[model samples]
Target chain A: MLDPQIIIAGVLNGLLAGGIYVLVAVGLTLIYGVLHIINFAHGSLLMLAMYAVFFLWRLAGLDPYVSLPLVTAGAFAVGFVLYRLVIGRFSHGKDENILLITLGVSIVADNLALLFFGGDTQTIDVPYAGDIIQVGAAFLPLPKVISCGAALLICLVLGLFMTRTDTGKAIRAVARERQGARLVGIDVEHVFAVSYGIGIACLGAAACLLMPTFYVTPQSGYAFVLVAFTIVVLGGMGSFLGAAVGGFLIGITESLGGLFLGEQLGQIGISLIFILILLLKPTGLFGSRA
Target chain B: MRHLALAAALLAAVVYPLLVPNYLATVGMLMFFTAFIGQSWNISGGFAGQTSFGHAAFFGVGAYTSTILQVTYGWNPWLAWPAAMAMGGLVGAGIAVLSFRAGLRGSYFALITLAFAEVFRIAANSASITRGGLGMLIKADQRPINFQFKDQIWIYYLAFALCLVSLLIAWWLTRSRFGARLVAIRENEDAARALGIDVFTEKVKVLALSGAMCAAGGTFYAQKYLYIDPNIAFGIDKSVEMLLVTMVGGAGTIFGPLIGSIALTTINELTRAAASVFPALKNVQPLSLIVYGAMLVLIVARLPDGFASLLGRRRHA
Candidate 1:
């Protein structure tokens, strides 16, 4: 039952899956760091973005990779506007209210997709979808390898944007000290919207990458969102490095857990980790003291 | 004057089922049943301000406990009901101690509860004692002694009575010292502790009470539907439903859950009926949910007191 080759293959597959998970967690951690509220709509928004990718492929002849930039930008705009219009205006300065409001947003967004798109599992068939790449004992799908690489590239770019740019510095300042940022003449609200946009933009890219290998339903958002949240929590809320590393860890857990526990009970590993981390250390691995 | 109004309302409620058709009675039953469960949520979430996202955990425990007791052990379901509540209370207190001892608050608490519920869901799905996704079905013993009624009107009355009981609990919470302590904790836990209140014990107590009520609701639900499954027993849907009714109704107020339940059930039935009628409109089930979701946002933003505030009475929730 414990084949080293099979375990190595599982590890490899988990790493491949982790790339996109990192992208998703990065978005969530960014939002939580800045806003101090869990965005419940994160999953629903991802689902909607996946639908966009699906429609782009179905309506036009655009491949998932080709449409990446478009969807990412569009997602950014959506996030920015959503913050300005709904989340910022209505939260009443309470984190709990924002959580509930986001919960509502997710409900609305999910049902809207159900109403408009119908409940169907959609996937894109890129011509090279079946292509494979071999490494060590593992045989990986070509698309998965490409997505993994692309996802990492996007994360590196995002990290650079966060650390190297003046806007990035200002966003960080706002995250660290909102009042202090305002005192220093930074536009706090603008920084907020920008951060939120950048966060959601990650999801857009994730959606594009995910379309090749994974199927999207109204539920894909929820499925990925929970895993992303686990990654974020495990990594430490708001820690980019944590998100990156935690993503791979969770991906491996899912793969290995399924190997040992069977499909039905395998999912428990993630939930258990989430519960334990929160109970033992709410700050997570990289988060500051709670 | 208030007492007279209350008497008149109770009078109307007593006569309502008799006057209405059996279909309408069932709808009323659903409204009251939801109100009962929603009120249980209101106790901890609304009144005590300890919002949970996994009340379904307790709900499932009650459901499975009663079903197993009746089906496997041959224990009467009526006897199993209180036993289920005991189990729910124990689970509730256990969760409270684990979380509160670690000082989990706000979203942390909410998310932990969700995780716990998920754990239960997975356990139910995998454990053979639960029959592992096959679900359990109650025997069709349609006699009053078995807690299953033939006419369905008795069940309606049972639901209505349950809702009334929950309302009384809410009313007591608003007036009792225990309730006051919970409210103080909600307003400011530090202040409550400063005022010589044991915040931890109070929170645990309220959660136990809320859990017991919720568990009773679960048993009622299992008996009503005559089926219990992992998904049905511990689903996020029930958690969402409990939260939605309380939040959309009035949260802390005595009448909030009842009002919210009626509004929710009405919207649900209306949208489903509309979809059935138009056929061209095809699916309004999502439409109703959309409406509920939008209402949640709007209420959180503009009407924090919910529709209960529109009653033109100045009462503290």
Candidate 2:
């Protein structure tokens, strides 16, 4: 049997990674809930946010943590404009068209990053970049611990907002039934824009949290986006709480999978689970039948 | 008038190869190969209304299987073609069974397919037989029996034949009951099921056929390219290229894949040529992808029916 400390460390690492997945997956589920379009470009939007944070850190000498709100706000504005200008035109179009459009957006965003950043992998260097915290027998990296906490806190705040705020209720109303929402005098289009913006805003926040610990590359979002997809599907689509739980589950799976299956096969393990879950329960663990 | 048009087109196809330079012939070969792949994709995607984003899985299986067989066992590459198709079909059937049994539709199905491809790619990367990222290189031999051609013309002819075969199959499908059933499923699955259509079985069968055809294209690709790498064989970009070619031509139509492939290949060649001629553009990143993305956006926004629809309108006029 493995050492208790090793297992605990792995679990901690998985939880940290799961926190990031939760944030990204929640955003994806939110967009899916309201817009009913699987935004293939969600990862690309996160890529852009990473770049934004990188530039802020490099040029303005701001720490990634300090720049979180700024990046989130910036991403929100961009997402809102993008929806109004491009996505709004195809709100009622075929699912395939919406899928293609978002894919197009992804390709454009990825190539644009390549053109501008020249494909070099960059990372932000903060004072606590090498710091660690001790938890009994297990040691936790400070960055991971902090980011994971922040992610959970954000999810909690989002949960409260969803249940408490009128706009949040309106968004939910639209998601449940668009026609009924419109009949009740909800501005469905505005809600869509807001939902998309919030979804992207989550990506921006995730970028800031992730930058300190992870390398930022033009293609970095591709793998993370895939992981987020698995998480969203496993947790149940359109369920925020499910995404959070699913995030932790995938995180733990990846960490333990890496520990046992070797580094490369760890990814395969996640994919296998994703496929099995999809085949066994298309509705996901917490999702209702569509 | 239709017969005359067909005769003229056939004559041009037969004679143009003899007249064009080898480089242009190579481009023509690529266009046709892409069209073949696109048409195969259309069987499941357009006709059956099942969008797959992981076709590269089937494609990569074909390329890797044939290449590995030839390299390891000195097997005739021609023999490897059927093996590739069988492998592709098996994988396709597996995916179809699992996904359909679970009732995965639309994006869920697409994502699952992507996951499978990614798994395959990662497996290829780690497996020693696949050479683990160094890639497999086939020796250049101009023997006809080895499926290697001394001249590019033979390759062009082979690709043209394959394209014609795929087109004929697609055309036959349009006139068959299976094709009609596929169309019914595409338009409305629940309604078709209510009408006594075995939705699950039909989808799996169509997917298997599509996978087999795509696998054949992969074998042809490996034989021509003389190299097999995980990235080249299993890349998501390859899958996207297939989808783009089919969609731009007009999904669900016999000639759509052909037109889309020709248009996309032309655009790609033109961009490369322009990039080479301009010194300033040399150091700059290649603009082909940006153009592709822009084209996708423009097409989705303004020309969802694709360029094939424009041709259809002119024919009616």
Candidate 3:
């Protein structure tokens, strides 16, 4: 018999988890939309950003919250340079080439982190790391609530920027029809670099948000990236709004699964949902058929 | 001349373990095992153009099935191998049916396979039957019936035979109508479908074959290593390694995966040797992986057609 309080707590935790998933999924979707590359290295880039925030917190005594801008900027530069130097060369290549290249990048990034960070799990001790807020029978951790709020705000800002800003519109246009956007005088290459930068910036922001709640390791990005992939697929690939909705759904599913099915089965539950969705609704709940 | 070269190569492979030390033979066996995996992956990825990132699902299923049978039921190891292959084929068919029926293609299909593999890994980690993260270990018995031998050469020969069989299958594909259809699908699925080919059936068939072959490789791995763990059998690294070897050698070609396995294994062995020589390099635990990553980037950027094409170009010249 499940307690009402447990259900409520689970739902709240799921929402928080969903918020982070949304950020990561959106970053992946954005990269896919503009570059037509799945960017397997997306998670690895987030891992690097997480390390950056960790280092900043450890060395400068800076809060992860305070280090958000710096991490995001650094991630953007890394993504931008990665595109110009390596990914750009394969822009016109086959899909497998792009996949392999990104996979390779991920391998390099992870091993480099392993070399420096020594495979130990690292976590930040934020002031609110252990604080909690109570609502009736339910309690939410302060860090989760803050991260959830920040994720929403970032999503909203990204949405507005995509819709309202000229550069954002150009990015959307390129995503919608690359040849048309090119014909209309959009600097395809510049837009690509910027889009990649923005995609990576999203991961950077997510890393900072995540550092308070989750442990960081050289391999941590991989698991999160897998979850993000599931969310993206569930939300419908390449659809921004779908990613947001899908993230919460996966988050809730995971929490409920853990409560009902045990910890390992909870992870299995997410994968099952992912496979079922791919089988039954390849277009996703909100995405139009490709 | 080509036939003579092929015969010479086969002779060399058979004589290799006899001449080399135990360590070198072990490395050669591992290289051949990788070649088997890469070749199996090539059926779906190179020929059919269904680049899966989750071949580990099949590999794990095969590995776990055989190991579980041998360890728990006291079954002969040779008997478990066929059963493992069958289980691998079933899983492969199931994935192919579900994905192809849903019209999933390209990246969507790839991710779904990965999810399935992850699901299997997690399941293995949780299920008591798999003994969870503690893993399963086969008792050391130097009996041929148990698929265990005291001499490392037996395992090497077995691995070599498996690699040869996989290569033959690949070669047969290149000469068969089914192979042509697969190539057509790879070139353009829509066009192939428009040409009256049963694209779904073809994809499913190839995937099943690929899955079974990969599972066979897994069974071989279990028999040689005498251990089966979720991480070793179902990890993303296994999947990526299959892709890396196949792509580096040339995905669709018969010799591509074999060549890639040899090259990659050599690189890995060299790096490990270097690490032992240099105290500083020893701290970098996964230096070979970094090298592999770098090689993948370079190959994709410079030799998209793989190293096999280089040989083709030379012959033409």
Candidate 4:
């Protein structure tokens, strides 16, 4: 019923949106792959990071790009200390306990944002927000295009860091075989804190990318939590490539779904996909373990 | 001694409503209603060790089903209530079969339930039958047969009665054979399976039961408020609230949800009163929730048994 050109445009739009999702999912999958627990607070933390970006811009007149590194560093420190102080200390190596703790953490974080940030939906006004980039049948916004490119570059750099660095190797080791890593004298606890830090750092980068196009509300974090989990599961938990691909696929689904199914029902596809993946093949694209 | 305590508590509840103002009576109703729903969650998540993150799916389904039947089809509210429970049970069974069949449990199960609730919410948002995002309103008629009441105290009694029924069901679970099997599954699923327990069937059964109970609570809520919307019907907040109460009180204990509800409602009311007094303390609602969040974390970490444990720590622990 639709023109091929229109369809193409929708797909392009979805892919651009999916870039931010990939960055968020990367953090989620890393937490999942290493900690072996679903970080229920991922969205809330991302929300906190978005607030940081908003304040940095609102208070200091700094552009999001300029504040990315500072916000990312701050997020990483918070994540590390949070794990050491509450999560690791309380979890006692139980997956379910960790899940509950994170659920509690997310509740706290979301409400904390509500308490401080108020419930108003805030968006940044970048000068180039209205600028457009034409690709084939699609005309993408400049901010989206920039965010997409930056997201991909960040993922690539993170991949290299994971594959090349000793700490990365140590993190991988811990993820693969925790006891073996411990036997080799890897400070497993330190690695956990670092991995959590890196995961939250990804969220920091994502917050900067998202602020240009998206609005920030206390509820925004809760909205992304499900989408991030869906993408992470779709990509195969802990698989960077899977997360990236899943991000694009989900993006396309969202774009097309909105185009065809209407805005209200378009979100049903994501929830259904999450259920189906969990039911039929939870390992996802690159995962061997469910 | 425990029986005497419960008897005294029951007597106090019956008379306390008579002594309280209308506003306080309404608060009592809310506390009991919350406890009933929380008990519904405790049945699956606590007693059966099947933690669901989307009990709202069942609650919403129940609320919508009864409302649609009564408003659209002209059924009695009493009849619609049972129909709602049946619909809720069917949905619970469907989710359970799909999930448990695929060997999902723990966090995976929790996530899937959340997704199902989302699906229901989005569908409800778009569907014409549900009136879209504008929400559906029940015609207000101050008649007992129609399930509407002119007097607030009567609704309070109804909520109180529902809480009592839920408490009885929980008490039965504490002593019944079905309860023992569910506890086994919660403590260790593989071992229960090894011992010839039909883990799959039992889980589906418990989920269905929990769903029915939650749905009944939903109908009660709709009747009290006379409104149902996509978000109000199938929101994550309701799910979290149910889990919070049960966990804060004591997950597996029969009285856990009741205790948790009392504690939370008291805090909620106190904060509300404080906010009203301060005028400048605009975030009292979220402030109280922050305390709840803190309490949830502390309870999960240091006091897993919840406040219920405080009364009977040696007996249960």
lDDT of each: 0.90, 0.88, 0.89, 0.92
Query: For model 3, what is the alpha-carbon lDDT of residue A269?
Result: 79
- TM-score: the better of candidates 2 and 3: 3
For candidate 4, write residues A1-290 as lDDT tens digits: 99999999998999999998999999999988897878999999999999999999999988998899999999999999999998888886446667888999999999989988899999888888899988876888999999999999999999999899999999999999999999999999999999999999999999999998888999988899999999999989888888999999999999999999999899899999999999999899888788
For model 4 the local lDDT of residue A272 reads 91
Candidate 3 lDDT over B236-312, as tens digits, reads 98998998898888888889899899989988888778878987777544787787788778887888768898998
RMSD of each: 1.6, 1.9, 1.6, 1.1
In angstroms, give how far residue A177 of model 3 lies from its true place: 2.9
Once superposed on the true structure, which residue ranges of model 3 sit more than 4 Å away at CA? B283-285
Candidate 4 lDDT = 0.92
| Model 3 TM-score on a 0 to 1 scale | 0.97
Residue-level lDDT tens digits of model 1 in A9-76: 98888899999899999999999999786988899999999999999999998999999999999999
State the TM-score of candidate 4 restricted to chain B: 0.98
Per-model DockQ against the true two-chain complex:
0.82, 0.63, 0.72, 0.84
TM-scores for all candidates? 0.97, 0.96, 0.97, 0.99
What is the per-residue lDDT of model 4 for residues B1-317, given as tens digits with 9 covering 90 to 100?
Answer: 77898899989999988998888999999999999999999999999999899999999999999999988999999999999999999999999999999999888999999999999999999999999888889999989999999998889989999999998999999999999999999999999999999999999999999999999998999999999999999999999999999999999888899899999999998988888899777787788788998888898999987988888867676
> How would you encode candidate 3's per-residue C-alpha lDDT over A1-290 as one tens digit per residue?
99888998998899898998899899998888778888889889999999999999999999999999888899889989999998987655567668778888998899888877789999999878889999788888999999989989999999999999999999999998999999999999999999999999999999999999899999987888788878887887789989999999999999999999888777887889889888888778777755
lDDT, model 1, position B150: 96
TM-score order of candidates, best first? 4, 1, 3, 2
